[model samples]
Target chain A: MHIVVCIKQVPDSAQIRVHPVTNTIMRQGVPAIVNPYDLYSLEEALRLKDRYGGRVTVLSMGPPQAETALRKAISFGADEAILVTDRAFAGSDTLATSYALASAIRQIEKDIPVDLVFAGKQTIDGDTAQVGPGIAKRLDMRLLTYISKIRELDALHGTITVERRAEGGVQVLKTKLPCLVTVLEGTNEMRFATMNNMFRAARYPLKVWNKESAGIEDLTKIGLKGSPTIVSKVFAPSPKAVKAEIIDTESNQPKDLVVTLLAKLFTKKPDLAHDIAKNAP
Target chain B: MSETTEPRKPARKKVELDPKLARYKGVWVFVEHERGQVHPVSWELMGEGRKLADKLGVELAGVVMGAPGEDTRTFCHQAMHHGADLCYLIADEVLRDYRNEPFTKGMTDLVNTWQPEILLIGATTLGRDLAGSVATTLKTGLTADCTELAIDMENRSLAATRPTFGGSLLCTIVTLNYRPQMATVRPRVMAMPKRDESRTGRIVEHPLGMIETAIITKVLEYIPDNLQGKPQLAFADIIVSGGRGMKKQENFQRIWDLAKVLGAEVGATRPIVQAGWVEADRQVGQSGKTVRPKLYIAAGISGAIQHRVGMEDSDVIIAINSDPNAPIFDFATYGIVGNAMVIVPALTDAFRQHLSTSRMAG
Candidate 1:
């Protein structure tokens, strides 16, 4: 079995902050790391490779610096890494993105047939969760998303069974092989890299593919030209003009504070107090 | 994912939409259901769809796909009560369970039969899973997790506004040249409209010409989540969330105490959940559940944009933090500067007493 995992490099969201004055992202100090969600997908793919004795190839589409993410995947036990980057692919939205990545996957299929494709549920930056399905539709593969567990995989029959998370219950779905699966977060814990794997990752000669090398011949379908949506305006959410009314008391003790706050709350909204009392279970 | 190596070129001019898409009219909301119960978010979208439909002087319709039973027909009636002018119904045995293939085919077939200019769906797991595939198959643009939806009269396109750049900024996206502009809004982000039982509308029936054998994916088993002791923060009227400022897991118990006294749900930030102070299901933020409660009491939360966007829509916000300059204070209706450990226990006791006294009086 040949499994391909798609990953992305995104800024660590915890360190991301907005400038108070200009309302722009403060990206200077934020470090770039593998998308936290993608790690789960990569880990799932590696575990499948371990069980089924298959080769896992990690793929990403980003700038040259994204090679670090691919190498990190290699350290996690991936057999190969490919980075798809190009000057013409700038300003691409999810549609253009899936097109480029799908084209790259087709090129990879020339060497070996890929039985399964894996991707993170969504990226932290876009959080659209559209690329996986877009790629699945473009490739004419069965798309299974928000998969929580891999119940069974019958490679001989070209069939796979998995549990998909739905609104109120879990749906155990069985689909054909050669499909795309978007793994959900918290599905599995990523494994720690071994020293030998780290050394191999450091020396692994990565495959770099551009738009031309990835077999994307349609210029209009690879970048900004293919994106149907446009951002008309980007602005900070306006803060509520009036600040919260601070309750003050003579003594700053917890008892005094509670009394004062309750008095004010009841005075302002008598119905809330009554409702809470009435609905007390 | 590529970066611009050279100077960026000027923005491209808007392209003329295909003439074929001009015939698409009306706005449709996909009414999501599970185990014969319609999700409330579907009704919320129906209310919002009414506004969009009225603005364009077009009809508002609800799309319902389910088994051939009374439940499906009842949902179509309820859809009209919630402001839908009509409903498109598709019934089949294959769609009895929520498999991606049959549901997607049913929805896409409806769109193709009677094209709707704007389609709104709830951003639940099932909705998200279905909308992406349907939109991709139709080769159109879809905006997910949109906080705001408006019709741009200039070009008569849907303007979908959602948080971008990790919730630091809001960007309004428009699918200028795509027909049946699609968007998914999370539950509770939109107000639930009052239902009018007296209202009735037309029901348009469509057939799902799919068979069990033809569909490759099969539903093996379904295990419903155990909701007995779990926190239903998404629909909770009141939520008390803790952040990193709680210091330790023991101190986090104050949140549970307060929630108990007030009959509210307990929520925690991502960091707190990561630190094992609370379960992942109780986390409320961008990465967690989006909640809009009647009252939200945030303790020790610094009001990071990610967490703020999730609960900012609550009717009333009360923030307690040591730092007065915390972003929570910027939007909170009431703010207290102090230790959360101290404030939380006192509030719980006060509510406990207040409720007991009221019960005695009544």
Candidate 2:
């Protein structure tokens, strides 16, 4: 089984802060990490390789710096890593990004037949969850998204069954091989890197491909020109004019504070108290 | 240096749609249903679609796909009650359950045949899965988890506004050249519309051409989630949520205590859930449940945009955090700048007493 997992490098969103006055992203010192969600997909692919005795290839598309993310994937035991980067790929949205990645996957297939493609459910930055399906459509591959567990994988029969999260229940779905899957988060724990794998990751010669090498022939469909959605404006969320009314007490005792708060709350909205009383079991 | 003085025009060119796409009309909402019941978000989108349709001077329609039954037709009438001017219905045995291949083909086929200008779907698991594949098959654009949807009358396009950069900033996106511009909005983000029983609409039937044998993916079984102890945060009248500041898993109990006193549901931020402080289902944020409780008390939550977008629409917000500068203070209706450990218990006791007294008085 040859599995290709797509990962992305994104700024650590938890530590990201917005400028107070400017309302712009304050990204100066924020570190970049492989999109957290992608780690689940990478780990799942590694697990599949572990069980099937096959190779796992990690793929990513971004600036040259994205090679770091691919290397990080190698540290988790991926057999190969490919970074598709080019100046023409700048300003691509989900549509164009999938086009470039799909083209690169087609190129990768020429070297080794890929049985499965794995991707994070969505990126923390873009959060569109569109590229995986977009690529599946372009490749004419079966797309299985929000997968929770791999119940069965009959490589010999070219069939797979898995639990897919749906609106109200989990749908146990069976599909053919050579499918593209977007794995949901919390499905598995990512394995820690071993010393031997760390050394191998550091020494691995990463493969870098640009638009032409990636087999992208249409210049209009590989970048901003190919992106159908245009971001017209980016602005800060307008602050609510009414600041929260701070509840204070001179006594500074929890009990006293509670008493005062309850008194004030009931005085202001008697209906709330009545509703709570009525609904109480 | 001698340079041609025509100020370098903005490098980006204004997008012009192919003349073929100009005929697409009407705003359509995908009426999502499960187990014979329609999701309320479908109605919310219907109400929102009504506004967009009115602005563009076009009809608002609902698209319902389900098994052949009266239940499917009833959903069409409900969609009209919520504001749909018409509905497109597709019924087939293959669509009895939510399988991506069949639903995507049905939806894409409907779009190709009926050519709606805009398509709205709830950002649920089923809707997201279907929307992505449908948009890809049509070679169009889709914006997910939109906070606002409006018609750009000047361009006759849908401007989908959503939080970007992890909800720190808001960006308005336009599918300038794509017909059937698509977007998904989280459930509870929009207000539920008044159901008008007097309203009526037309139902145009479509057929699902594919059969069960053609779809490679087959549903073997469906195990419903155990709802015994599940929290209904989306429709809760009151909610109390905790975050990383809760310090430990044990500390989350205080949030539950407060919620129990008020007959409310308990919610947590994503990090807290990821840390194993709480179950994943209790999480409330962009990646979790979007809630619109009547009163939401956020305890120890710093109010990141991801969490805010999920619960900011609550009728009233009360924030309790030790840090005075927590972002929750910006939008909360009331701020209690104190340790949640100290304040949550107090609020719980207070509510207990207050509720008992009210019961006695009544």
Candidate 3:
């Protein structure tokens, strides 16, 4: 019943800013936090470990400083930590990312066979929501994304039932063990780390794996070259020179403004006026 | 359980098992079908994928799975009309119902054998479920919920741009090394291409290959979704949408009141929708429905990128939120920085008094 929680170190969204001139994000000096979504995954893994009596391993792929995220994972009750870091692994997209991770998980398997893998539904930094599925795919495991609940878990039987939020409603799906679960946000409230756990995390000796150590054989397949898609450019969303026209909040009363707005609005969209009149309060 | 002190396993290098994934060619879009009808998002992806294929100079194709001769091919022809150069139709009895195992295998087998250069699917229930399994089986890169896709001129590759960081920023991802760079686009991101009835494409039929017995999961019954009273936001002309600025879940009732008066679909920001105050289907954001309402009244929604991506294309956007600096104001056609709780009802009252009275007077 050993569990693995995969997390990413992301620039805090609140502090993220796009370079006005470059139209690219200004990443410098932005403090990194555990991707908000990944926290839910970590919390879920911890809850499972507490109930199942198994050790939890926190793993991350980032630069050396990203060890902080792994340490933070330890503070939240992960028993072991692994940081897959290398200059080569930089710029890896979901595809290259999954390749590196699958190798590391296999390496971790030698230490302890991972029964369950937990990840955030999607990283704020990479909203593609592909990595979890990619990792699950590479590992040949079942993937459960947008999961609202883990209705039941029969660890002994290697069966898990969960509710996945679809477009219109939810679908209750069942899958066997060795599955990757990407948790939806707001699924559970994260608990505060105890002082003991915090101290343990701060001092924990993390295992840092380079590309070779991570079991990535083909150097070309683990980074930018491995990626088939390339970002030719990124620009800020085209902004309207004039923001939304201000409907005077003060001079014109709400009721009066409503009249002018309706007059102007209906002149433009006559059908809307008719539609509103047809469905009166 | 005690922590195991087992030593790590030595690395085993296998060349044959991990050989360069080869022979896979072409670009395919999964024509997502559910409840006997195909989702429009599938067509949208085909149009988008058509551009990506043309850039790579690859043939654009559609992979469809459904009951034998059950309008699936006609739907494939429709896809060809939209943009597909070829349609890979897999008609099987097992595929009539949208079960995971059969569709996953059917699509995966087609992919493994054909080795499409790129595979696109709509980010729908059937798409996501099937994409996850197929991508996993093929062990390739799969991007989801992309706002933009392009062929990187430098490499002639697919450049998938999506909102990263919960819509706070955007990231461009490439599956440079993987064949069939996989991605799923949310519906409405791409404009549905004009269909040409006269346009024709070759049809290559592929068998489901795997039998029903080979699949582990079985769909006992579909319980077709109850659509009788569903809100049709995508097709709505006038929409009264609410966001977190409404401050309280109960305040959404005001939006409902206004929408009821306008006969408009009620929409909400991703946050409010996720808050359980409304249905997820009513969510209008990057990960939700991209709307084109004729007249849109947004109550209390600050335009986050997530919400903006969905509603920005509206014919008219009128924002009403208490915060003057709310981002929704930036793109709205008009703005009123006052309590939606108060502003909405006032607007509602004003609309009722004017529209009803005008009707009576006329």
Query: Which candidate has the top score in DockQ?
Result: 1
Question: Highest lDDT: which candidate?
Answer: 1
What are the lDDT scores of the predictions, listed in order? 0.87, 0.86, 0.76
The segments of candidate 1 whose C-alpha lies over 4 angstroms from its true place after superposition are A278-281, B1-16
Chain B TM, every candidate: 0.95, 0.94, 0.85
Q: Chain A vs. true chain A, TM-score per candidate?
A: 0.97, 0.96, 0.92
lDDT of 3 by residue, B1-362 (tens): 00011111211112122235535567788888765567889888888888888887789998888998758878888888989888988989877766666777788888877878788988775577677667767756677788888876554456777665446555566555567778888777787788888889998898877776765443332234577778788867889998877888877899998887777889988778768999877988765688877788998887877688887878788888788888788899888777788889988887777777878887
- Candidate rank order under DockQ: 1, 2, 3
The true-versus-predicted C-alpha distance at residue A158 of model 3, in Å, is 3.2
lDDT of 2 by residue, B8-106 (tens): 222135546688898999899999999888998999999899999999999999999999989999999999999999999999989899987889999
Write the residue-wise lDDT of candidate 3 on A58-90 in tens digits: 889888999999999989888999999988876
User: If you assessed candidate 3 against the hidden native complex, which CAPRI class would it receive?
Assistant: incorrect
Return the candidate ranking by lDDT, descending.
Answer: 1, 2, 3
The lowest-lDDT stretch of 10 consecutive residues in candidate 2 chain B is B1-10
Each candidate's TM vs. the true structure? 0.96, 0.95, 0.83
By TM-score, the candidates rank as 1, 2, 3
Clashing pairs in 1: none
Candidate 3 interface CA RMSD, Å:
9.4
Interface Cα RMSD for all candidates?
Answer: 3.4, 6.8, 9.4
Q: Which candidate has the highest TM-score of all?
A: 1
